[model samples]
Target: MEVLLAVVIGTLYGGGLYLMMRRNLVQLIIGLGLLSHGANLLIFIAAGLRQGGAPIIAEGKKVFLTLPADPLPQALILTSIVISFAVTAFALVLFLRTYQEVGTNDLDEMKETDT
Candidate 1:
Protein backbone atom coordinates (compact mmCIF):
# COMPACT_ATOMS: atom_id res chain seq x y z
CA MET A 1 0.00 0.00 0.00
CA GLU A 2 2.81 2.37 0.87
CA VAL A 3 4.58 1.43 -2.33
CA LEU A 4 1.48 2.13 -4.33
CA LEU A 5 1.11 5.53 -2.73
CA ALA A 6 4.74 6.30 -3.41
CA VAL A 7 4.33 5.32 -7.01
CA VAL A 8 1.28 7.53 -7.37
CA ILE A 9 3.05 10.46 -5.77
CA GLY A 10 6.04 10.00 -8.01
CA THR A 11 3.90 9.84 -11.12
CA LEU A 12 2.00 12.95 -10.16
CA TYR A 13 5.18 14.88 -9.44
CA GLY A 14 6.68 13.83 -12.74
CA GLY A 15 3.63 14.75 -14.75
CA GLY A 16 3.23 18.07 -12.98
CA LEU A 17 6.80 19.06 -13.69
CA TYR A 18 6.43 18.03 -17.31
CA LEU A 19 3.38 20.19 -17.69
CA MET A 20 4.92 23.09 -15.84
CA MET A 21 7.70 23.36 -18.41
CA ARG A 22 5.22 24.17 -21.14
CA ARG A 23 4.56 27.72 -22.38
CA ASN A 24 0.79 27.62 -21.95
CA LEU A 25 -0.63 29.29 -18.85
CA VAL A 26 -3.41 26.73 -18.57
CA GLN A 27 -0.98 23.86 -18.62
CA LEU A 28 1.07 25.58 -15.95
CA ILE A 29 -1.99 25.85 -13.76
CA ILE A 30 -2.76 22.17 -14.28
CA GLY A 31 0.83 21.32 -13.41
CA LEU A 32 0.61 23.28 -10.16
CA GLY A 33 -2.56 21.41 -9.24
CA LEU A 34 -0.92 18.08 -9.90
CA LEU A 35 2.13 19.13 -7.92
CA SER A 36 -0.02 20.11 -4.95
CA HIS A 37 -1.75 16.77 -4.94
CA GLY A 38 1.57 15.00 -5.10
CA ALA A 39 2.84 16.99 -2.15
CA ASN A 40 -0.28 16.20 -0.12
CA LEU A 41 -0.02 12.52 -0.91
CA LEU A 42 3.63 12.53 0.12
CA ILE A 43 2.78 14.07 3.46
CA PHE A 44 -0.04 11.59 4.02
CA ILE A 45 2.15 8.63 3.19
CA ALA A 46 4.93 9.91 5.40
CA ALA A 47 2.52 9.93 8.35
CA GLY A 48 2.19 6.17 7.95
CA LEU A 49 -0.94 4.03 7.77
CA ARG A 50 -2.72 3.14 10.98
CA GLN A 51 -5.99 1.25 11.20
CA GLY A 52 -6.75 1.97 14.84
CA GLY A 53 -5.58 4.72 17.13
CA ALA A 54 -6.12 5.81 20.69
CA PRO A 55 -7.65 9.13 21.58
CA ILE A 56 -5.40 12.00 22.62
CA ILE A 57 -5.56 12.82 26.27
CA ALA A 58 -3.49 13.65 29.28
CA GLU A 59 -1.91 10.61 30.97
CA GLY A 60 -3.05 8.49 28.03
CA LYS A 61 -0.86 5.49 27.40
CA LYS A 62 -0.48 4.17 23.84
CA VAL A 63 1.89 2.47 21.46
CA PHE A 64 3.16 3.86 18.15
CA LEU A 65 0.87 1.91 15.86
CA THR A 66 -2.03 2.28 18.26
CA LEU A 67 -1.78 6.07 18.38
CA PRO A 68 -3.68 8.47 16.21
CA ALA A 69 -2.13 9.67 13.03
CA ASP A 70 -0.06 12.79 13.37
CA PRO A 71 -2.31 15.83 13.20
CA LEU A 72 0.41 18.28 12.20
CA PRO A 73 0.88 16.90 8.73
CA GLN A 74 -2.86 16.78 8.12
CA ALA A 75 -3.28 20.34 9.24
CA LEU A 76 -0.35 21.52 7.18
CA ILE A 77 -1.61 19.70 4.13
CA LEU A 78 -5.07 21.17 4.53
CA THR A 79 -3.70 24.66 4.87
CA SER A 80 -1.45 24.13 1.90
CA ILE A 81 -4.34 22.85 -0.15
CA VAL A 82 -6.45 25.86 0.68
CA ILE A 83 -3.60 28.23 -0.11
CA SER A 84 -2.95 26.38 -3.35
CA PHE A 85 -6.57 26.76 -4.36
CA ALA A 86 -6.53 30.47 -3.69
CA VAL A 87 -3.30 30.86 -5.60
CA THR A 88 -4.66 28.84 -8.49
CA ALA A 89 -7.77 30.98 -8.66
CA PHE A 90 -5.70 34.14 -8.65
CA ALA A 91 -3.40 32.72 -11.27
CA LEU A 92 -6.33 31.81 -13.49
CA VAL A 93 -7.73 35.32 -13.25
CA LEU A 94 -4.36 36.84 -13.95
CA PHE A 95 -3.81 34.47 -16.84
CA LEU A 96 -7.15 35.39 -18.32
CA ARG A 97 -6.42 39.08 -18.05
CA THR A 98 -3.01 38.59 -19.55
CA TYR A 99 -4.48 36.62 -22.39
CA GLN A 100 -6.99 39.35 -23.09
CA GLU A 101 -4.57 42.24 -22.89
CA VAL A 102 -1.60 40.53 -24.50
CA GLY A 103 -3.58 38.46 -26.98
CA THR A 104 -1.53 35.37 -26.26
CA ASN A 105 -1.10 32.61 -23.67
CA ASP A 106 2.51 31.99 -24.48
CA LEU A 107 4.60 33.19 -21.53
CA ASP A 108 7.67 33.47 -23.69
CA GLU A 109 6.15 36.34 -25.58
CA MET A 110 5.82 38.40 -22.43
CA LYS A 111 8.46 41.09 -22.21
CA GLU A 112 10.27 42.24 -19.10
CA THR A 113 10.08 45.87 -17.95
CA ASP A 114 13.61 46.45 -19.21
CA THR A 115 12.62 45.13 -22.63
Candidate 2:
Protein backbone atom coordinates (compact mmCIF):
# COMPACT_ATOMS: atom_id res chain seq x y z
CA MET A 1 0.00 0.00 0.00
CA GLU A 2 2.77 2.40 0.89
CA VAL A 3 4.64 1.53 -2.26
CA LEU A 4 1.55 2.13 -4.37
CA LEU A 5 1.01 5.51 -2.77
CA ALA A 6 4.64 6.38 -3.31
CA VAL A 7 4.45 5.45 -6.97
CA VAL A 8 1.30 7.48 -7.49
CA ILE A 9 2.82 10.50 -5.78
CA GLY A 10 6.03 10.17 -7.74
CA THR A 11 4.18 9.97 -11.06
CA LEU A 12 2.13 13.04 -10.26
CA TYR A 13 5.16 15.06 -9.25
CA GLY A 14 7.10 13.95 -12.31
CA GLY A 15 4.25 14.71 -14.69
CA GLY A 16 3.80 18.09 -13.07
CA LEU A 17 7.41 18.98 -13.54
CA TYR A 18 7.23 17.94 -17.16
CA LEU A 19 4.13 20.03 -17.77
CA MET A 20 5.64 23.01 -15.97
CA MET A 21 8.38 23.05 -18.59
CA ARG A 22 5.85 23.45 -21.39
CA ARG A 23 5.58 26.67 -23.40
CA ASN A 24 1.94 27.32 -22.57
CA LEU A 25 1.10 29.31 -19.45
CA VAL A 26 -2.10 27.36 -18.87
CA GLN A 27 -0.20 24.08 -18.94
CA LEU A 28 2.24 25.52 -16.44
CA ILE A 29 -0.60 26.44 -14.08
CA ILE A 30 -2.01 22.92 -14.39
CA GLY A 31 1.41 21.54 -13.63
CA LEU A 32 1.66 23.69 -10.54
CA GLY A 33 -1.70 22.43 -9.31
CA LEU A 34 -0.69 18.83 -9.93
CA LEU A 35 2.58 19.42 -8.17
CA SER A 36 0.79 20.83 -5.13
CA HIS A 37 -1.55 17.82 -4.96
CA GLY A 38 1.35 15.42 -5.28
CA ALA A 39 3.25 17.23 -2.57
CA ASN A 40 0.24 17.13 -0.24
CA LEU A 41 -0.25 13.42 -0.87
CA LEU A 42 3.42 12.76 -0.32
CA ILE A 43 3.32 14.59 2.99
CA PHE A 44 0.23 12.72 4.07
CA ILE A 45 1.76 9.40 3.20
CA ALA A 46 4.98 10.26 4.95
CA ALA A 47 3.03 10.73 8.17
CA GLY A 48 2.76 6.95 8.29
CA LEU A 49 0.02 4.57 7.23
CA ARG A 50 -2.01 3.72 10.32
CA GLN A 51 -4.54 0.93 10.67
CA GLY A 52 -7.16 2.72 12.75
CA GLY A 53 -7.59 5.39 15.39
CA ALA A 54 -8.21 9.11 15.73
CA PRO A 55 -5.32 11.51 15.63
CA ILE A 56 -6.58 13.80 18.37
CA ILE A 57 -5.06 13.45 21.80
CA ALA A 58 -7.65 13.05 24.54
CA GLU A 59 -7.05 14.39 28.01
CA GLY A 60 -5.06 11.94 30.16
CA LYS A 61 -4.58 9.47 27.36
CA LYS A 62 -2.32 6.60 28.34
CA VAL A 63 -1.20 5.12 25.05
CA PHE A 64 -1.97 5.04 21.34
CA LEU A 65 -2.17 1.79 19.46
CA THR A 66 -1.67 3.37 16.09
CA LEU A 67 1.00 5.85 15.12
CA PRO A 68 -0.03 9.48 15.12
CA ALA A 69 0.26 11.55 12.01
CA ASP A 70 3.04 14.10 11.72
CA PRO A 71 1.24 17.42 11.68
CA LEU A 72 4.30 19.39 10.75
CA PRO A 73 4.45 18.05 7.20
CA GLN A 74 0.78 18.76 6.66
CA ALA A 75 1.27 22.32 7.84
CA LEU A 76 4.26 22.77 5.60
CA ILE A 77 2.40 21.39 2.60
CA LEU A 78 -0.55 23.70 3.27
CA THR A 79 1.69 26.74 3.39
CA SER A 80 3.48 25.65 0.26
CA ILE A 81 0.16 25.09 -1.54
CA VAL A 82 -1.08 28.56 -0.64
CA ILE A 83 2.15 30.16 -1.76
CA SER A 84 2.14 28.14 -4.97
CA PHE A 85 -1.43 29.26 -5.66
CA ALA A 86 -0.48 32.89 -5.23
CA VAL A 87 2.47 32.49 -7.54
CA THR A 88 0.40 30.64 -10.15
CA ALA A 89 -2.28 33.31 -10.06
CA PHE A 90 0.29 36.06 -10.47
CA ALA A 91 1.87 34.18 -13.35
CA LEU A 92 -1.49 33.72 -15.09
CA VAL A 93 -2.36 37.39 -14.72
CA LEU A 94 1.00 38.34 -16.10
CA PHE A 95 0.48 35.97 -18.98
CA LEU A 96 -2.89 37.48 -19.77
CA ARG A 97 -1.52 41.00 -19.61
CA THR A 98 1.37 40.04 -21.78
CA TYR A 99 -1.02 38.61 -24.33
CA GLN A 100 -3.08 41.78 -24.28
CA GLU A 101 -0.05 44.00 -24.69
CA VAL A 102 1.76 41.86 -27.21
CA GLY A 103 -1.21 40.24 -29.02
CA THR A 104 0.09 36.67 -28.97
CA ASN A 105 0.27 33.59 -26.77
CA ASP A 106 3.40 32.20 -28.32
CA LEU A 107 6.17 32.83 -25.83
CA ASP A 108 8.82 32.42 -28.44
CA GLU A 109 7.30 35.22 -30.49
CA MET A 110 7.33 37.54 -27.50
CA LYS A 111 11.08 37.58 -27.36
CA GLU A 112 12.73 41.01 -27.06
CA THR A 113 12.18 42.93 -30.28
CA ASP A 114 14.05 45.94 -31.59
CA THR A 115 12.15 49.07 -32.54
Local accuracy by lDDT, each model: 0.87, 0.81
Instruction: Name the top lDDT candidate.
Output: 1
**Per-residue alpha-carbon lDDT of model 2 for 32-99, expressed as tens digits?**
88898898898888877665656666668777657666567767888988898898788789988988
After superposing candidate 1 on the true structure, give the runs of residues whose Cα lies further than 4 Å from its correct spot: 57-65, 112-115
Q: Candidate 1 on 67-98: residue-level lDDT in tens?
A: 56567777889999999999999989998999
- Model 1, residue 65: what's the lDDT? 39
TM-scores, all candidates, are 0.83, 0.74
Which number leads on TM-score?
1
Per-candidate clashes come to 0, 0
